[model samples]
Target: MLFVIHALDKPGALGARLAHYDAHKAFLSDTSALKVEIVMSGPLVADEASTMIGSLFVVEAADLATVERFNAADPFRAAGIWERIAITGFIRRQG
Candidate 1:
């Protein structure tokens, strides 16, 4: 199944996000290397161009639990930037 991982940053946590940005990108690259197909992923930005507020990614996994594990292992999560996170199974219906 495809799972969407939605994570919201805590207010004023952009510094941490910036600090851990490289690691987060590395994590996603590692997942891609491991064959956990990523459909799309990117940071959610605020009205201010440089202000990032969250992250969103759609990934293909065997099950929801697999996605949960991936989420738990995110560098952003480890860096304590995410104040709220949500994961849900997704089924794409059209192009």
Candidate 2:
């Protein structure tokens, strides 16, 4: 089973994300069970000025419970950067 964790940052929570970025990266690097396939995270781009709204990532996990644990332990979660986190079971057909 593979799981995808989608996390959206709270409004005006860029600072929190940035603050925990290093720890988050470190945790990702250390985690062995979770395989990060595509990690493309940035601002939501809501205006001409392009203010950041949230983040997104595609990860592989053994099970939903494992993914939930991983998400719960994430530095972003600890730092209160995520307003909402959605986890979905994923099936890769092409890649």
Top model number, TM-score: 1
Residue 47 C-alpha lDDT in model 2: 62
Q: Report the C-alpha lDDT of model 2 over 1-95, residue by residue, as the tens digit.
A: 66666677788897777778888888877666544443333344456656555655566666677768777888888888889888888777765
**Poorest stretch of ten by lDDT in candidate 2:** 35-44
Candidate 2 clash pair list: none
- Top lDDT prediction, candidate number: 1
lDDT scores in order: 0.88, 0.69
Each candidate's root-mean-square deviation in Å? 1.6, 3.0
TM-score of each: 0.90, 0.76
Please give the lDDT score for candidate 2.
0.69
- List model 1 lDDT by residue over 8-85, tens digit each: 999999889999999999898878544478899998999876679999999998987778778888889988999999
How many clashing pairs per prediction, in order? 0, 0
Worst 10 residues of 1 by lDDT: 28-37
